[model samples]
Target: MRHTVTMSPDSLWGLPQIRAVCLMAFAGISSFAVMLAALPVWGVGHAVPAHLAGTITTVMLAATVLTQVVSPALMRRFSLRGLLVWGLVLLGLPAPLYLWATALPGLYAVSAVRGVGFGLLTVTAALAIQVAAPPGRQGEAIGLFGLAGAIPTMIGAAIGAGLTLSGNFGWVCVIAATPLLGLAAARGVTADGTAPGGAGESLPMRIALRRLVVPVVLLFAATAAGGAVITVVPLELTGSARAALVLLVFGAVTAYARWRIGRFTDRRGHRLVPQTLTVIGAAGMAVAGWGFAAASVPLLLAGAIGTGIAYGALQSVTLDLAFSRVPAGQAPIASATWNAFFDAGTATGAAVFAAVAAGSAGGAGSMLVGTGLFLLVGLATVRSALAPWLERRRGPGRMEP
Candidate 1:
């Protein structure tokens, strides 16, 4: 039935609905990246305690993660569109607060609210793409959507950081809030684009949860490593420029891999793709660990590229598979589940890696542990989702074909 739904031949960027959602997503993410990048720098420059300066991000991310976990359940009684609208309001209205003389507590509160907005914006738009995309073109649509986030990540951080580093904090807030204005335009799109059932009222909680175990676990392992890398890599590198380069490379590669995953999946289907990427990720972890131990820049660069490839591929495959496992009506629940694992794993990974690496030989040991986690989860994913498909590799790759 879903395959029968008509869509433009271009699949990704052709339809009006997709274009609107992508445009809004690009702006929303840009707002987040630019402001998020600037805020801590501004705080640290103003002589705020390092711990306090850092808490801004930690608090916001935690809040965002929490919302991702809870919002889908609330959809039983509320409309997804309504929630998204409120979320946008929360996200956008708080931007100007940065220019004010708010106390630490006040700032923290604002950050929390904005985090909720970001969470809603992210999950809603993701599901919308799946719901509205043309038949046989979901992967391509997601890949195009990935561009919205990727572009901002590549440049927003630099602009935000450069601005705040130069003591132009006021402009950071203004710029950060500007993209959110696009939300108003997005509101004119259809509200009834999705079916209902994200909250588990339509399906038993146990069943819904059990169906998600494979993707959730895989995402958890992958994102855990991702979080650790983001948190520790910069600290391990010798210079700020080197650290920036590593992150930039990681982000660019990740975005490209995400875009490519869709195209690959459209042609190949998911079958062994996630497993393959996980193996590559494990090797990348090995490279990263070795680089950390030897302090080798080239190894680090290679590791970032490899790890990013796996990260993006895994992310796309898991979420896409999650939606495929259930009815279209339940996409929101799947989205929430996928995001919860992603957010929780990231936070947990950073903390655990920091703890273990601090007392061990060096970052290398922690990275090796990351590799171990990926191997474990990758095997689980194969057994759970790909085992039957794996047997069909003797033929053409697609399960249908």
Candidate 2:
């Protein structure tokens, strides 16, 4: 197996394919992220009902999740290169159409199409990472890819929202078309989606999904917390500049932590990683929420740093663990499933957080506090109760519990 062969740490990055995937992933995700923040603002500015403003994002995410769920089946019919190139086209070519699609129906239609492209782009790119990275260095390679993805999302949102609010929707659309530039990168990646050996083909999808459920849930919760913080902070802060600064801090911390955690887990293993990060996330959420409520900049910034680190590390740790639990042949399925849950978690968090902010007097702050507490309780239940229950459920002949 390629993973069994030793390679230099830097060799993974040296591969032309790895660099291509990273650049394509960055450009593709940046396209999605920029518009994700802009569309809602555009809706609100265009006099879409306040209650329905967030539906723009929800609809797009719904399309994305649905596409991801069925991507494995799609992969059977399409090459990864075909998917990547077409996905970029589908995601990018529609940017200018937004100019004409100013109403709710038009916006949703365009978003849904772009969302499908996003779904195609994300799943294919993730699988490409598995295919492109050196066997032994998959963890670090995935981390680097995560860092590529994380940066654009954080900065893209800030830029998109800032630009849209300042009456530069046209510029936002132009920037959102960044995926168009990635077409060249897309062409450089491996076209085949087949796993190295056919061994993983024997593993049932049900079994692969069952083993992955724990990590998927963990990822979902962490993303929810992170998404809530990212979506709500701007609304709660009095000024755009402060909100942008907080977001920048959060993104920077997350990008760096994800990259480092990949290397750390590659060496030390991942048993304690998720639990520890969850605790950090809980505390970060509480502090940030309190800071928001009290209007303290320092506490808010501090909380963002902690939350970013926890969220970013968890992203790396959980993904590595998920891939570890599955056989190599089943990687595409794993990637699709993980990406689906990741998007679903973010969408759910954004919607739920926005609702709480709209309805509650304490608003986003209280929701953050409650989310933090929820994480703590969830951690306790998983460690004290769920782990043992799962252990007892595993049969003696089955793979290690």
Candidate 3:
């Protein structure tokens, strides 16, 4: 059998396909980050109910999931650039809608439209690099791709959301829309969704999904906590200015950890990575909840820093492990599955916490609940990661756990 050689993480940057993926991922993620920070404020400011406000994200992310499930077929039908252009259009054109979208249904409509665009951009951009990378280097290549996209989001989320805290939704939308417009104008990327090895004779989606469950669920839990923070922490923190900083800390730490920990995963293999991430996540959640309950900004900031690191590491490591579990030619399936778990987890977390926030202790109770969930999930993932290692120690002939 012929084998494809892997590119070292540093060497991988030289490839056009990977570069294009990074460029697009940066544009897409930055756009989403700004809007994500701004829109919930917009909804609540205009007197939309908190529960209804949360549903906006739910609809948007749900739309993302719906689009991603069918995205592989869409990629085959259109040029990757063509699809990306549309995704950018969908992402950008609706910016001004937020200005006029006062009614609940109108806001949800705009969010849903934007969500489809995000779904397309994310699915295509992420898988593009996965297909582009050579063998063995898949984990590093994806990690770097994630790192490149995250830096802009870290900076932009703080600045954009900080401005939005003062009711500057219009400019945030403008900022969100501008980059994609420039990219589309440049027309630098013009390619279709062609895969290496032809990705020949695709496996049925149902079977592929079944193979992806374990990694996907762990991802779901981690993202659930992250989604909780993104959705609630901003609204619940002492004030929007300070609250915005919490988001800043979250994004900054997340970006740094993804960059640093990813290379470690590539070099060391995935052995303890997932379990370690869960532990870090649980600790962060515990501290964050403690801060929330006590109304301590310092502890809150520290918690955000810790959770941010875990969130970043969780994202890169989980996806890296997901790819490891799949067949070489099934990059699209892996991308779709990874994306779904993330979006779905985010939507679920947001809605769940939003429901709880309307209660007596405000969002502090929600934070405590989130801490418990993280601890349980961390323990569960550690056990899952060790099960196979324990089995190996017992010998290959052993089947029972």
Candidate 4:
């Protein structure tokens, strides 16, 4: 027997558990978003080498990935509320430390510590959703969850970038402290002592990894592209409000697409959507690359909008797919694995794009253009290679599940 949550959208939104998780997610993600653009820009301003500054993100996300990998074990050893509380503490307490750690190595150290906290938040937050949501409503629940995360990105990235550029670092620290407010909501989360999927019915980690390659690849590619944009554009377009605007539009569009696509996928299914989004994202990267290389604000804004839609939609879809492919009890495994890919891809993009900008004459814009071409070619190759195998597996005319 399985549990089913059959409720209207309003009713679902009204659930105490849902409200608690959303508030917590909003606070945690806001802390992350505020620092995402600000830290790199701050590093560049304080005598850090341009190329090395991007590594701030790389270091943070590297820690995030490592923490996510070990989160399953952590969840088993601790209370969910305890972990969530500590994650918020670690994430918030370190922001003010940035004021003292002006050196590159010190900054990286702070980022790495913060990343650990973020890692705990990412997996635990998703697990909270898994436990709170009713059967058959996972997509909508994820959409709402995504919506909470997106608003902060939209508001925080632009604000952080803009503020840091204006030389207002203390304010950035203040905004980064927002995660502390989530402590109240964390207590209300419906956490039991057991890890999700601890029962014998769950699949082994190795098998789950094998079953999840498709969504993981799609998620990795999309996040890599988006992360490159977020990491490099601030450095490339310094001293101009245009950079902030570009980030603003990207965040706004991403929020709407991620939230809406959840319901759409629930009704229409997931078959063609991921491929279509990849195409759109690849194209957006190309346009934005041209915009960056050319320093055209309009083109940058246009590119941001296109990529934002694809990035947000792919996030929701990949997550929903990850949940759907696993045993119901195995949600924590899926959440941790998916989040690890998410941060790993972002870190890879930040490092690779920053290196490309440093090495290439055409800089960030050129890197974006090349990345777009790479994604396009990769997608086409993957489809060509997979179609034959799929046809043989499911018969010539069957739709993919």
Query: Of the candidates shown, which would achieve the greatest TM-score relative to the real structure?
Result: 4
TM-scores, all models, native as reference: 0.82, 0.90, 0.90, 0.92
Using lDDT, give the best candidate's number: 4
Per-residue accuracy of model 1 over 1-401 as CA lDDT, tens digit each: 12333335554576777877778777777777676546655555556553355456566768888898887766555655666666677777788887763456766788788888888877887877787777777877888877777677655654665556556777778877865577665664576654366444355667777778887788888878776566556445546566566667776887788777876687667666777888999998899899899988889889988888887777777777777766666777888888778767766665566555656556798789889998988887676555455556666543221
lDDT of each: 0.71, 0.75, 0.74, 0.80
Global lDDT for candidate 2?
Answer: 0.75
Task: Give the range of the ten consecutive residues with the poorest summed lDDT in model 1.
Answer: 1-10
On the 0 to 100 scale, the lDDT of residue 30 in model 2 is 86
Model 3 misplaced stretches (Cα beyond 4 Å) = 1-11, 182-190, 195-207, 397-401
Off by over 4 Å in 1: 1-8, 34-56, 76-79, 95-108, 157-175, 198-202, 354-362, 389-401
lDDT of 2 by residue, 1-401 (tens): 01223447465667877788889888988888777667766787787764566677777788988999888877767888888887788888898788788899999899898889989988888888877776567778889989988889778877777777678889889988999999988657766654343553447768888878767777887777776766666656646677777777888888898888877766655655677787788778788877877788888899888888877887877777777778877777788888888888778766676566656544445447545654764575355323434566784332321
Evaluation by lDDT, superior candidate among 3 and 4? 4
Question: Lowest summed lDDT over 10 consecutive residues: which window, candidate 2?
Answer: 1-10
What is the C-alpha local distance difference test score of candidate 1? 0.71
| 330: Cα error in model 4, Å | 2.3
Q: Arrange candidates by TM-score, descending.
A: 4, 3, 2, 1
Greater-lDDT candidate between 1 and 3: 3
**Which pairs, if any, clash in model 3?**
none
Off by over 4 Å in 2: 1-7, 193-201, 373-401
